[model samples]
Target: MSNIEYQFSEDFAREMDKKDPLAGFRNEFLFPQINGNPAIYFCGNSLGLQPKNTKAYIDKELQNWSELAVDGHFEGEDAWMYIRQKSKPALAEIVGAHTHEVVAMNNLTSNLHFLLVSFFQPKGKRNKIICEAGAFPSDQYALESQVKFHGLNPDEVIVELAPRQGEHTLRTEDIINKIEEVGEELALVMMGGIQYYSGQLFDMKSITEAAHKIDAYCGFDLAHAMGNAPLSLHDWNVDFATWCSYKYLNSGPGNISGIFVHERFADNADLPRFAGWWGHDEGQRFLMEKGFIPMHGADGWQVANSNVLALAAHQASLDLFQKAGIKNLRKKSEILTGYLEFLIEQISGESGVLEIITPRSPSERGCQLSLLIHKGGKAVFDSWYGKGVVGDWRNPNVIRLAPTPMYNSFTDVYQFGRILEQSLAEFA
Candidate 1:
């Protein structure tokens, strides 16, 4: 809870929009238009709108490739070979990590598998992994496959923590107790920093500390948390973390992902990993040496050459992130997302059809608010969608609306409220 008094009137929302420091950023994106106007795009938790400058960034690279051909890897303004290096500083700033600690690499699930290969070290009694019950499907698959690869049964080695009966989110105390209970058997604690379905932001620092106290490695799938929340991966002493760039980062869909490995394990030559030539030492990389001399930091986790065009798109969004400063963006996010929550409450007033599953505290969530729709389910969501309120609907009955600070505004959230009221009146 914040001190700001939220009101339901459109005038109040417009006033907030007028005062927003980040309001100019909304114009920087190419929105999905509705009836000649931009749609109420509260879906950054799924896919962010393209930055208006994305085309220029990508075109520069295409030009460089055409002119330089094989020499482009060394000669361009952002050389193909060093393209990942150029994006590292901004990425590090976004995630609160050192320059060498973070790298833009493969997609989310691929990075998860790669990180697990090195970090999910199960030995003797320490063979179990803990994750949330309804973690994103890809994470579930990665964890299960990793466990099976070790000749362990996922059912026996994977401990899924779920919310208590009738509860919407996991209690931090319960999570701490579970970590302590698992004690010697816990090999890794892997979960989302911000849960994808319920939009609950887990206490990552506390969770990391708890796991460490029990001698267990801790990591996060930060796909939903990356550009939406403030992270201190290095300060938190998180073991390793990975995230996709397409969501709140405003990178295009299926764009490159990012990874963070704490400084302690980054330079450890003895750490077992699945390596490739790109992860080789840059100087010796061209030698094609038989031995894989891994690079000293997160780059060592890379399995192939940089995805040039994908990186161009990613870098364009990261430039905005650098200019906007994550701390400032987070401050505005709290207010805008809070406004959305307040509006939802107003629309659902005394109505039993919809209930917010996301936490009420501003500190315990990102930009997204997940609504559990009890009646009309998909039809209610469809009505809102038809009205151009572009939120994401999950299975059974969850509609997630995220007013991303980088490009979303108070007026956008306000318009979503208007359409939501109409949707409920007609369907629920």
Candidate 2:
């Protein structure tokens, strides 16, 4: 990954694409058109493009519902009763968890709250929570409410680790040191697997081990990491985790979220949780009994029955992941993103027109590069938008671009480089 071989030419981009083993995957997604041609879409960090098969997947479920109604639960080709099970294996593979430890249910924040009810148990003096500063707004709200739920002040009970002075990303050593600094008071250590804005990928294995050393539970909000980066949640001994499928997973907006709980908690029925009938033991669920006998594994945390249509849409993307493999996707991501980085540097030259806030090392980031534009600001971003470049803007100054491996190409990166050069000349 040192000094990647890149050229700012369409022929070079096309030749590189021809060498790509995963190039065929670009055809599987539908992209938005700009001026009678596909626009350069580098905003996958915010929302992934829809898979072409997604419509067919949802249609099958809709057909079953039309003909069978309630009987669709027991009757269809993909029975609604076992719809979650169908997605389990594929989802488990993406997150590197055992089948029973992964379940698709609820949205990201809701799943976070449900997981906190069990993992965020604050006792006596060990009531503090550790997280990165400037976490996604939903996570910030969830942490604030969870702390307040236990009758503790968030300012005192929550320890937010910030980058020292002028740095844009958190150092791994700093994160681990903060965990030790909090020591006995630290009840839980939670962070985004990859920060949404800076796009730094944290070392989950190291973080989890450090938390365990301090006798605290550890988990991650994998919203930006799940399909974008390779993860071994179970092997990392992560206590609990959750992720939404819309961004990197390419599921529709507000689609189902997945959760992972280690096998140690698989049969610990005494673990307190907010339960619904779907979470109860399947055999006894219909008996309508008074006492709640939770199901074993992550399924025990589910609060409602499966959403067949949404799961169907999710399964379509999972199928592609199964076919393409996370390791392979990550391999290409490094090259694609590195090319974007190289082109950006070449465009800015030594004038310092843009600064990449994300880590320079490929190992420390996914496909995203968050650029701090020095001068043109939002007007420059709007000019790029006019030219059909689709990178997202993060208030004030930063513009984030993600050249996703699944649907984006080397050609997209090349076009982006050319358009950016034009925009900088015009705006700067």
Candidate 3:
């Protein structure tokens, strides 16, 4: 949406909603209530609102378990043993990978640790890792622990790339230059697909190419990018990636996470990984064999059996995603986020109090806009929260608002603007 064309009025928001192709999706989710009224939910980046059909999906699995008992694992079309496979198509579509390249499994941190074991091969003098300076704490801990596990000093082996002085986001050129400067010593290049705080979407394809040119594996932690942004992980040649479903995927809080390994590693059974029975070939799995023959493709990385209930919830959300289509969702997302940005910019005018730290370009961001409050930040956030404006507040001053295309509407953004303006006046 053009800046000049956006207006800060209810009628404008309503008209935009009327024209939105994905507008019906808003009713598919059950919004949280505040004083018997539905909230203006803008926290999908943190935890997406629950889908209405999620209960029915879970109930089916519950019924299966009750009626079939031990037979549940092998019985019916939605068999427990193959439940994870049900999510592959939707997940692959979301992340732009082949079905064989993706799998829903452990939580993000565990999957990160597992993928690091296979990808972060630090040998000889080429034993350095590169990542963003202020990555999410879990990622920081995972990298540090992994480096230590390999008997390397995190300080010397893990190279953190920070934004330039007074800058809120990293430049792609600087990232490429760092990859070149580190050169032979860089063993791996791992970064968040979209920085959780700033909501800056990195140029993954360019980063992957640069890392490959340096003979280093490149991967991403897509906690914020999985469903919020458009990705082509396979075409970009990313070595591996992992993400949680609780956030944009809306599977449920702290639910299953997914991983994407390039097709190049699909048939490479010799790849080092901590394997379990579930990852073994199904034909030989029940034999209780001594040799671990892993299933081909990303399924080989699974360390345990599928989480049936979680997968059921995940499949419910994925089914919605399949029906709505990622392409269509992304289209609505751009305009919804753009509209939110426009409203925020209008509110911030001459106040110098509310500042958007997220990238201005639509191509460089997803649904999220990170607002850096210069004054009375927490108080303003508290006021908004009290008034039923559901947004995430980062430590110190940032307010992250994600107008998700799956459930949020143009009117939601408009309502948030109204609440924000009142809060700023009373607090800031």
Candidate 4:
């Protein structure tokens, strides 16, 4: 119902809001209600607002624990033995993976290490890992630790592709060329599913293909991308990937995360992996045998007992994704984010003070826009936040506006744009 052909105005946004099919979904979230009014929350790209059903899902598990105790693992309603099983179908849909290819497990960083143990096998001249230069601190740390784990020097073995001088994005050709130039020595390429700071959605399919050309593994950190964008981990032929449920997945703060393993390595008997009892064949798990016979799919990578409460929270959120559908969310996302982009440009015209750092094409980005505030720094951003326009600020001078489709309305974007315009004028 959003008409992108016309210029965005307060009336235009209100009209579109009236016609939005997903408009009603906003109320299903448990936004902070101060004085009985929902706060204007525009931070789903960082942490999604909680679903109304989250407590119910968690309560089911809590009841099982209190009443059934150890028996809950096998006998309670929503049996814990198969609690993880019920989640796989919905998660597979979101990531475009086969049910066997995905598993919900430990937190994001832990899953990253588990996947790396299996796929990041560097040897001989193939000892380098390639990633974007300004990746999230956690990812950079993981890559550095992996390099040291392999007894390699971080500087010599880590290949960080950076943005061009005076530019904010890396062109596709630049990425392809980096793979080609370093493919021989590259052990793996792990990138953000959507670059956190700039909101760039890296072309995972192309990157996977390019990396495989030189027999290198490719993976992604989907902290910013999962649930915000449509993904095809299996179809893309990616070796492995991991994502946090806390961000776009809406599983609450520091919830459990997940991983995907392509079926190709699922049956590979010789694939290198760190083994544990939980990953071993369930039938033989209680036997506690010396030999570790792992499961054949992504479940094989899980190393310990799951945190049931977090998994319950994750299922509560993924249920919303299932009901709305990733493709449908993406459909609405294109309109909502495009509307934001259109309005920001309109308000800041000819000012030379604000520039968008993310790509213009919808395919190249996700729900967030990285605004490079020209004349002001974080102090200016603080002023906007003081006015109840909630957004994130990167270190030096960038304001990230993520108009998440599930909860954000055209009206929220319209208002946020107006606030940005007001702040610029007041500060200037």
Best by the lDDT measure:
3
Tens-digit per-residue lDDT, 363-420, candidate 4: 9998989988887678777887777777888888888888888888988888877777
Q: Write down the TM-score of every candidate.
A: 0.98, 0.98, 0.98, 0.97
Candidate 2 similarity to native, TM-score: 0.98
The runs of at least 3 residues in candidate 2 whose Cα sits more than 4 Å from the true structure, single-residue gaps closed, are 2-4
Q: Please give the range of 10 consecutive residues that has the lowest summed lDDT in model 1.
A: 419-428
Indicate the residue-level lDDT of 247 in model 4: 83
Better of 1 and 4 by lDDT: 1
Q: What is the number of backbone collisions in each predicted candidate, taken in the order shown?
A: 0, 0, 0, 0
Candidate 2 residue lDDT tens string, 1-428: 56557889999899989989999999999999887788899988888899999999999888999999999999867889878998888888888999999999999999999999999999999999999999999999999999999999999999999998989999999999999999999999989999998999999999999999999999999999989888899999999999999999999888989999999999999888998999999888889979988888999998899988999999999999889988999999999999999899998777566889999998889999999988878887888888898889997799999999998999999998999888777766
Give the alpha-carbon lDDT of every model.
0.91, 0.92, 0.93, 0.86
**Which pairs of residues collide in model 4?**
none
What does candidate 1's lDDT look like per residue over 286-393, in tens digits?
A: 988798888988988999999999999998999999989999999998888888888888888878779999999988999899999888988988888778888899
Model 1's alpha-carbon lDDT is: 0.91
Question: What does candidate 4 score in Cα RMSD to the true structure?
Answer: 1.6
Stretches of candidate 4 above 4 Å error?
Answer: 1-3, 33-37
Q: Identify the runs in model 1 with alpha carbons over 4 angstroms from their true place.
A: 1-3
Error of 2 at 165 (Å): 0.9
